[model samples]
Target: MTIHSVPGDFHIPFDDLKVVARGLVRPECVLALDDGSLVTAHGQGGYSIISSVGEVSHHLAHCDTARKYVPNGIALAPNGKMLFADLGNQYGGIFSLDRHGHLETVLDSVDGTSLPPSNFVMVDEHDVLWFTVSTRNVPRSKSWNHHVRDGFIGVIDGDGARIVADGLGYTNEIAFSPDRRWVYVNETYAQRISRYPLTGSAAKPRLGKRETLVQLSEADLPDGLAFDVAGGLWVTCIASNKVLLVRPDRTVQVIVEDSDPAHVGRIAAGIRESSLEHADMQTPGNSRLGNVSSIAFGGRDMRTAYLGCLLDDCVRSFRSPIPGVALPHRSRRIR
Candidate 1:
């Protein structure tokens, strides 16, 4: 898979992308470390590392005995702890997965009631952790309903866990603006990206009114989000198997769309099983299918953006037109 950097009117074709690994079990959210290794949450209840070239390395932390801990989104803290969201029902919430595969609860409940299954997480530069819960309604499949709006965005800092925002349509990834003045979140079921003003201090901030930044087509289900240095948002749309670029001025452009029908079918099946079964699952790593779950920028100059998948066995890569804005711990790994 080779994606070329060329000019196009509607969208830039993603060419020259190489599959980094094969045989991953529903790898969802991926984060690139300083040492060139990628950490991603697996649907099989743990986390795995991918080499710079895409080899599936050893498990960073696995929980075969605790299969209910469906690792969803992940972020590595400066203290060497991997904070990840558990989408399982029995033990759903945010947890810190240690190198030894031990799990420690971070934010399971607020005011006593248990938190719903977590979706995505982001750790800011100030060590503040922000996470989202898709919804409390379960058999786990209820989250697929677009009308479900019980989802919420929460914050965990030195203080504690607090609900910063609520009433969302299946929230997925969360990102901050380059200027740190705005917080963006992807409403997957709603097929839109909404931005909220970042008020108060960085460590203890507040989310202001919700503003729709971009409303995607109904056929598109927006998922992961990343920001390029040019202040453009790179969004991965699931089901539709496409990536989108939303500019600061709210103009949306299709960056790339996977044309493989077989891959698309597999992705759609994988998602269906997830909603109905709510159990552990895996996928055959082949075909560069778009069920893209997350995006991150890495490489020597930070121009390489990696696309993590759900049904695809391997992660995909492509070069970006501009460098991506560095995350809080971009390329930094735990020693």
Candidate 2:
């Protein structure tokens, strides 16, 4: 199949890009900090310390001796603490960064059992931390079949957290409604967004109602997500190799696409470099849907779009018309 670059009013040209660092990067979530820095929560061969320029730094000094590393989400605190969604082990949990960039476990479990390889972590307005657990047991993957049958969306009250919604088909992402009245999470296996209405109740463990927002097929697996200032949703297409804009009306639009597969750069030496600088290749065709995994806002007004690619081991960015909403405020503490 051929691929073509998607055009839209909110799109920006990929002419001005700055390389910070590269090499074995699995950056899942990105934050365009106020101080002109980009923080990436990358889980790969190992967790990497990264900057906005796409530079990867050394591991945080203080971390437990964990065998594997995979972080699916992250957020920063006003006081400079950073929280990461740790998804490496079977029982995923949350890790934090001290002032010295040392890693520490903040909230790893509920009821004495660790979170099940939780995905995105969102700190809401009340300082409540919200995230998703793909399964209590890691899905066994034999060849292409995934056997993760159950999933849950959860929230942590000041000292405790509970699964608010369950029996979900692989809940992989979590975001609050713009009005703060509902929580939205993408069921990866189901290929749709499931939302739960929320009142101001404390530690609400329930699902009032549900909406299947934007049903995506295997053509697109709903992965990373962020909202625009206008409340529109931005989702990454894991298989389609596109950035999809989901409007309030649930209309899906392809905002960007890669036309030149030949020019597509991969990370080298822990930094983004052109591997085909010497190899002669034909001009890229239109654009083929690929594995575009995650996306976030950056650049001057949070209008820049960054994409996570699963096929290649690097992150890519482009321009967008809308600005990104700031990470919400959520209070979470481990008991």
Candidate 3:
């Protein structure tokens, strides 16, 4: 397959974007369906659904309101249910929300240890559930240092929940290669993309030797990941508010950017000095993309790119020249 380079001057301008939905609380992860509907992670408790015509309705989990339920990365199950990674202050787990909004714990602990605040959750083509834990640190912010590396990935299937990989540097989002031969993940603090060879049955999956695919600059702290049909991996950076495309040949291209140069410089310096703090990761005031965290391809042709953000109350949409590789749940009907 020929992987053509994107034009050096090509970029998605802020004026070209359209708001798809509003009144959201930290719509961190977005999933676009074939019917023009979008499901995003709601910071308050559950997931919010946006209709094709721009109607917004939130289905919150029926959980205790005392402790905040911060839903980060979410996935749609084949059984017409929604699975979300709860990044709570005092607890963390993978929860399932049914059509009736009933919340149930799917997997809160692996082996016997309780999970820390989770980061992302995904369902692969085989219907297996995978999740990431950014760190075991109490504050979580402490693990933001490049020297910290306690993050890990776990899987849930017929054999039950267990950690598949560990000792990662602040793991964020994960994606599977189109052919299902490998699984790719982003190590936020490490500023790199790594992949592990996939083997074994779905119930007892094994991740082979880890291989670093792309090493990004300190300024580019990758937060989300998705793939295009042309084999280009799209990554969204947080503080920088930039979207990058890593082509099949592993060359990187800047697809869109909306960062304050001075803000990025400070972040880069902090990362290099190993002194990054919570304050340094805050969204820049001049950001136009709301500190985009994830990118998903929607629309009938899969050319409509929807951006999930941290600071914005709505999901942002722009057109993509290349269609995205349809996710396993894209065609499944939402119950």
Candidate 4:
């Protein structure tokens, strides 16, 4: 793995009219709705709906997805149903939603115990819900320290659910490989992306055993990865203040850098919400609003890259050379 300084002249891309939501307080999770509007979960505020151009017009049924912590991850159920993962502040849980944002508890406890921070979520064609529990047990604000242990990947089968993978450290994000045989997760504190083969094995997948698709060091924090239709990864790096295009050959190059982290701080200083290994890496440029927390491909063709910046309270869309994975219909509504 080689790192390039990318001459000082480099610049990360920004939008001409970044979407700021009047109704959203601090958006922690965002998903594209079926009508092309966006469904966002906040740190304290609650869930909201926004326009393609970034207008916050309506609240989704006054739904509250978070507890001590606001919701962290959200996805459309396979049936176009609304499903969001919550950090329950002390424990984690998964909730369901309606277009208007009505809420219903789906699977709150796992393996007879309550959850610790439901960090991420994804649903497949069969309605088998794939989600993450940030930790099996951990304290608030200390989640980063256990990234490699608290992590567990499970499927809520048609009849509710059961734990499938266990003992993941501060697991933060989950996405399926294009072939659907593997689940890729990010260890925010460990600074690596682990790929677990979903062959239905009984044993817990160990970090030592799973392939590390990407690794960041003390300086770089890797977060919010998305797959292009080409099956490659578009990964955000906090330390370098850039997004990377990673190929299967284990080589990476900057897709965009020039991100404004002046407000967030340089890699050495750290971003406010950044995890342990890359704590000082998320600083956003004064003009950037905040660090890019989430990215989605939504447009009629799924070619536009939508960036969700938690700090700024808005979403930005960009034209990418590579196409992105088409999210399932329940969560993706392209107006």
Best by TM-score: 3
Which ranges of candidate 3 are over 4 A from the true structure?
A: 5-8
TM-scores for every predicted model:
0.86, 0.75, 0.95, 0.78
Instruction: State the displacement of the C-alpha of residue 44, model 1, in Å, after optimal TM-score superposition.
Output: 2.1
Give the per-residue lDDT digits (tens) of candidate 1, residues 104-150.
77787975788877888778888788999877777556666455677
Candidate with maximal lDDT: 3
TM-score, cand. 1:
0.86
Off by over 4 Å in 4: 1-23, 33-35, 60-69, 78-80, 99-101, 146-148, 158-160, 200-209, 238-241, 258-289, 330-335
TM-score of 4: 0.78
Clashes of each: 12, 22, 0, 32
- Alpha carbon lDDT at 237, candidate 3: 91
Tens-place lDDT digits, model 4, residues 232-321: 776765434456666655566666654443433444343234443423323454445365666777667766666665566666666666
Scored by CA lDDT, what does every candidate get?
A: 0.75, 0.59, 0.87, 0.61
Alpha-carbon runs more than 4 Å astray in model 2: 1-21, 44-56, 61-66, 99-101, 140-149, 202-207, 258-290, 310-313, 329-335
* 1 or 4, greater by TM-score: 1
For the record, the alpha-carbon RMSD of candidate 1 to the native fold, in angstroms, is: 4.8
